[model samples]
Every structure is written in C-alpha cells, then in structure tokens.
Target: MKPPDARHSQAEDARLLTDQNELARQEALNGLRQFDAVVEMVEYHLQPEHRFRFRPSHLLHLHRLALEGISSYAGTWRPASIQIEGSRHQPAGAHRVPELIEELCDYVNDHWQECTPIHLAAYVMWRLNWIHPFTDGNGRTSRAASYLIPCLRAGYLLPGKQTIPDQISQNKKPYYEALEAADAAWSERGTVDLSAMENLLAELLARQLVEVLDHATGGHVTLPSAKENPSS
Candidate 1:
C-alpha cells in the first residue's frame, strides 16, 4: 500500500492536531454528546426488530416522531406515504427498500475479507439512496443505518467511534451528489456496479473513520479502527 492517499490523510492530521488542553477537549466532547444522542435514536430504529426496519422513510420519520412526538401510524410502506429523495413524489428505483439494506448486509457478511466494512457500508448507503425506495425519508434512514453498522462493527471490530458522519458531513452535498451522480450513471447505462463504487467509498471511509476517531475521543485518538483487516 502507498500509505493513504491525501484524501485519507486525516489520521496523520489527527496525530498532530489532538494535543489540546482540557477546555478544547470539553468543547469537542460536548459536540459529540449532542451528536451521540441524535445518532442513537436513529440507529435503534434501524434494527430489524423495529418492524419498520427496511421501510425507507422509517428512520427519518422515527426521528421526528420520537423526538418531536409527531403523530402518524408506524411502518406503513407506500410510494406516497414513505418518500425519500431530492425531488418529492418521485418513487425510488425498483431496488430501493429494505431489501437493499439486506443485500448490503449480505454483501458485507460474505466479503469482509475482500472489502473494508466501512467502505462496504458506505456503498450500501449510496445504493439505498439511489433506489429512493420511500416517498419521504430515505436519506436520513440510510444515513442512520450507515452510521449504525459501524457502531455495531466497532463493538464487534474494534474500540473506536460507533459513528462516522463527522468527516462525511464536512462536505454534505458533495457526498449526496456523488451518490446521485452514480445513480445518474446507472440510469444512463441501466446497471450498477459495486466495484466502481468502492473507489469512492474507500475515499469516504478512510477519511471518515479518521474524523470519527477524533470526534469520539474528545479530539484525541481514543478509539482506533479496530477492524482486523482495514485496508489501511
């Protein structure tokens, strides 16, 4: 390996950047704390036991429903009822739904050795959004599950931050655009390929993991990538 590309250089920056005093650490911890609770609710709703597990807008709607006490019956899946996309009222691709997530799980389960779980998770998320299965909240739901897998992986893979949107969030629209652009590519060609996706995903995760390492550790590297075979 040629070390990480520049896009993946956050770890090196982290090593240099995290020697701040207690005050800075406190500030960072505070931000992480707020973010933590938000993600927790998001991830819990992602579990299969949630009944609405694969429903596209379920996660996003659940967030508002849980925190704001918004009223609506739960787990109803219909094009108009559960929509998610840049444009409203547009039905997602045929593959966009809980099955897309299940397929991601299946892919990661079998190919952990061949691909980084973080990268695979990112790709899965990308596909989920493109499918645009729901009528309302696919982005938030995919975003939640994307974060959730790593949290689960951290519990199982290593001792690091459970979520990683910090880095991904640094450039939000670009991330969304990348995914949407890939979808556009698929629309033109009528196919999607995971390998083409991995390149973008690798850049996203290697950097995002480094950011998560900082975010969860009060700006220090408390939780490293515990993944046994992280490509890095």
Candidate 2:
C-alpha cells in the first residue's frame, strides 16, 4: 500500500483538478449568457430605420460581453502588448490599439456602402483578430462583432440553428488559415487582402442559411430559441 502522505497528495490533486473544471464550466455558462444579451442588442439595433453606426465603443461593449465572467479586463483595451500563439502574425502595440480601433470604425462607417455585407463582416473579424485589442477573449469578441456586422448591414439577424461564430469555433483551422493568408498579404505588400476570410465567411453564412431552411422543412436540428444561450 502507498504511504498516507502519498494518498493524501493524490486526493488533493484530484480535488484541485475538479475545482478547475467546474470553474471553467461556470465561466462558459456566463459567457453564453452574455453572448445572448449581445445578440439581443444587435437585433434591437437592426430594427427598421434604427440607423446604427459601427463604433469603437460597440467593439468595447461586445468584448465586455464576451468576457463578462472570465476576465476583469473585459470591455477595455490591453495596457500591455499581446502575442498570438502558433502564428507569425503580431498585433499592433498596446499604445496603438485605441487609434487603430478608431480608424477601423471610421473605415467601416465610410465604406459601409462600398463593400458588400459579407466583405465588411469578414474585414471586421480579421482586423479585430489582428488588433488583439483585449487581453483575453479577443477571438470571441471578434466573432461576436463579425456577426453584428451582417445583421446590422442586412437589417436583420441572419437565421440559423447555428451561427457563423459557432461554425468558426467548431472548425478553427480554416478560420485561422484564412486570417493568416490575409495577414501574409498585408505584411508582404502593405495591402489589406481579406479575400480568403471573405470566402470563409460566405461559406459559413451559406451553411447557416441552409441549416435554417432544413429546420423549417422538418429537419431534426433545433433552432436557437429566444431563451437559448450560445455554447462557449
């Protein structure tokens, strides 16, 4: 038999692991609740003749929602530089985030009519990921902001049992590849090349719409109800 101290240490380790897992689960639940709230707000702004203008504050608010229970830094820009893992791309310096975000908002507002909704949404997602404005939850915030673009520009929430954000999270390889492709193009030639990301977004949106059609035609998939929260 093992020594009593050894047995006690194993038990203590197990308890710590369990506690960590439970904390992760609770954090996920809270994030989902916040995502639902953000979705509701997006829908509200998309109402007829509401005239919503995309702004830096909107991104800040969405970031806050995405990390409501996970990080104290939610809804605020990072004060220190951040690095992306497993990628060659580097985000802007911490001090430049505020100005860059303002430029992003202004660019979107000015080009709202010039670009198609899908292109615009893709740009937002890619740029936010590139900016890495927050200390954590940047991807979540970016995806949420990306969803908001199509809804706001198209004047309604896109219907689906699964959203683009869900699809991106489920299969991140393609998403990351697309972002990296855009990054490479910009880094090499100083031009914003979002065609790859645009294609991915288009495919996801198409799949989402197809899912909606299937549900309407008696498919087995259940649509997200008003009370349904996003899965983190």
Candidate 3:
C-alpha cells in the first residue's frame, strides 16, 4: 500500500518499507558508483578488481582533488579564516602545509587497520574538515575524503556504495545545523568525540542508505546524482 506521498515520488518512496536484506543490497551498489565517480574525478583509480582496497597514494590524490575542487581558490592552500575552531591557526607556513598533509595521511594509515572502515572514514573526514588544512575547498575536500570509507566499506560489506552528498546537502538549514551541532560537540580544539561524530555520520549514512536502497534494488531512486559532488 503506497502512502499518500508514495505516488508522488516513487524513487524516494520505493523502499519506504523494505526488508533489511534488499535495503542493504541496493545501498551497496550506489556506494560503489558514487565512490568510483568521486575518485575518477581526480584521476584516482578504483581498482574494482581488488574490491576497492584503499591505496594511500590514491586516497591522497583524491583528497588533493577535493581540496582543489572544493576550495574557493583553484590551486592554493592556506587558512580560509582565522578558523573559529576548524583546526589550528598558527600561521601555517607553505612548507608546513606538506607536513600537515603528511600528518593527515599518517592518521589514515594508522587507523586503516584499527577501526571500522566506516568509523575511520567518518572520523578522518570530520577531522580533516575540522583541520581545514586547505585555504579553500575545505568543505568539498572533506566530503570527498569522507566518501572513501563508505565507498570502500560498501565494496567489502555490500555490493555497491552510493553517494550521500545529495541527501546531506538538502535543506541548508539542517545541513549547516548538523555541521554546527557536530562542531559544538567537538572539542574546542576541534577534536571530536568519535561517538558523537559517528552518530552524526550514522544519520547521513542511514539516510543515504535509504535513498540508495530505494532505487538500487530494481526500483527508481528519486534524488538526482550529485552533478559534481556538490559545489563545495
């Protein structure tokens, strides 16, 4: 029985109520496609044959892309603002940027084996954004970075992983609201509570999961694919 809103948007309502297995399957595929697109945008390889094993070089390349594409400036890296609390604001030197980049890479490498791919992914992304390593595109870079976990996780856990930018970007009020909320819960130094960060990620992940499932399992999805991974 379709609900009153069901007929209006089949893609969205298709799986308003579906079995757990079917929902999981559809989401996997979406995750794969989105992850592939994002990585490809920055000339990163997916290595589908390997089931999306995350490579450091590729991940770094993707992060650079997000930093480049998402930032307001095309090819520069500096503090966008005083950074109310994004990361640190100690007048990072040009050379220091590379060092900071390494730190981020090292963090990912260190956690690659310790946490759930999703947990690692979410924390890295949130932390990266909070770090605001780049002057511009910090938002876009962070988002792309975040996708890595879900994308790879999907390959390992599900068939495909879909993009969640659309679901998350919706309603600027809630979008920014979530960001603000997460930021507040985060330590003044920008360090976040993993549990809180995970919860926030869970909401986005869960919503995207639904959208992916809705159209993924032989149904039509309503949310349009992110035209270009969000404007930043």
Candidate 4:
C-alpha cells in the first residue's frame, strides 16, 4: 500500500525540507493527525476495564504524533538547552527533562484521587508546558495529554464542539497569561498553584459543553455568550 500523502518522500523527514511553505503545510497536517490520535487514545482508555496512567511514554507518543513531519526531535527529549519564546521563565536544562517529566507524571498519578478533574487537567497542562520536554510541539502535546486527563477521569470522553485545547489555540493571550500566573506562583514560593489555569479550563470546558447542548437542542436554548463575557 502507498504511504499517506502527508508522509510521502521528503515529508517523511522534516530535516530535508527547505521551503517554508512545505514546512507549514506539513506542520498543519501533522497537527490534525496528532489530535485525531489523541482522541483515539482517549477513547481507548474510556473503556470500562481500561485505566489511564500518566507516564513519560504517553507524552513522547503525543509529541511524536504532534511533530512527525515537522522536526527530527519530534519524540525525543532535547539534548541541549532550549528557550520559550516571549517568556521570562527559563525551562529546565535538557539533561533535566527526563527527571522533570517523570516528576510531572508522578504529580498527576499521586494526586489523581484527591484532585478535581479540572485541577488535575490544569496541572498536567501547566506542568508539561513548564517542562517543555521536546524541541517543538510542546504546547500541542501538553494540551492533548491534559485533555486526556479529564476524559479519563470522567470515565468517558467529554462532549464538545470545540475542545479546550482548540479554544486555547484560538485565543492564546489568556492561556499564556494563566501559564505566567502559575509560573510566578511557582517561582516566588515554590507552590504548585494552578488556580488560573483551572479557572481557564473550567470556562472553556463549560463553553464546549454548552456548545454540545446547543447543538443537541437545535440552538433553542440561548446560553450566555462566552464572547460577550470575555473577562468571565
């Protein structure tokens, strides 16, 4: 069988790409595939007997799916230092990535029972982004894994038109601000504060569910608009 068009030839290895347009196209395609795979993963874990386990391997799988045709470092931890553009917080050194990721999974698994779904989801999102494990696709992988947490915790996939990650991707200013808020708390007092991120996810998740309800009822129910209350 012929390989998928997106994975054909030069697209098979992003390192060979020189044209900016091809790179952009491939990234977009990879992103779609990544999200589809994430949804599949969530569905698999939603089964009655299957339980979700937060692990470094899951993160790497998501990261690989996220950047399969965009970077050679797709699934592997970076071997050198990295920087987060437009952010003052310095990520852990490359050598520290493995340990940091392990700690992240440990935090989620350790707090799995005690924490609320939103809190756990927020922690996964913030801590994974804070770790910045890969050379690229960090945000995408983080969002995918975070979304998975809530779905697994609920024992079923969450209903939505636009996912929490899709909402955040559409408007990143608030997402970045929430991340910075968590970072500030962490840096100042060594706290794992994720209230800002929790609130953000709560709002987005509400909006997503509202959309589902609206779709189900054929738009008869007029819910308050998320657009009008941007500050809320």
- Give the per-residue lDDT of model 3 (tens digit) for 86-171: 22223344456556666766777677767776677666655555555554344545666676566555543222244455445443
- Candidate with top lDDT is 4
In model 2, where do residues sit more than 4 Å from their true spots?
A: 1-19, 219-232
Q: Candidate 4, residues 33-83: lDDT per residue as tens digits?
A: 877877788888777677777889898988887778667878888777777
lDDT of 2 by residue, 81-199 (tens): 77776667778788999999988888789999998988888889888888888877777778888888888777667788688988987888788888788878888899999999999
Clash totals in order: 10, 0, 14, 0
- Tell me how candidate 2 scores on lDDT: 0.76
Better of 1 and 2 by lDDT: 2
Worst 10 residues of 2 by lDDT: 5-14
lDDT of 1 at 191: 63
Backbone clashes counted, model 1: 10
Which model, 3 or 4, shows the larger TM-score? 4
Instruction: Write out the backbone clash pairs for model 1.
Output: 82-134, 82-135, 82-136, 83-134, 83-135, 83-136, 84-134, 84-135, 84-136, 92-132
TM-score of each: 0.48, 0.82, 0.55, 0.86
Over 4 Å off, model 4:
1-16, 222-232
lDDT of 1 by residue, 59-177 (tens): 44433332221113222232332333243223344445466546645665566557565665676567666555443334444555565555554443223353345545455655655
By TM-score, how accurate is candidate 2? 0.82
Ranking by TM-score: 4, 2, 3, 1
Give per-residue lDDT, candidate 1, residue 201.
50
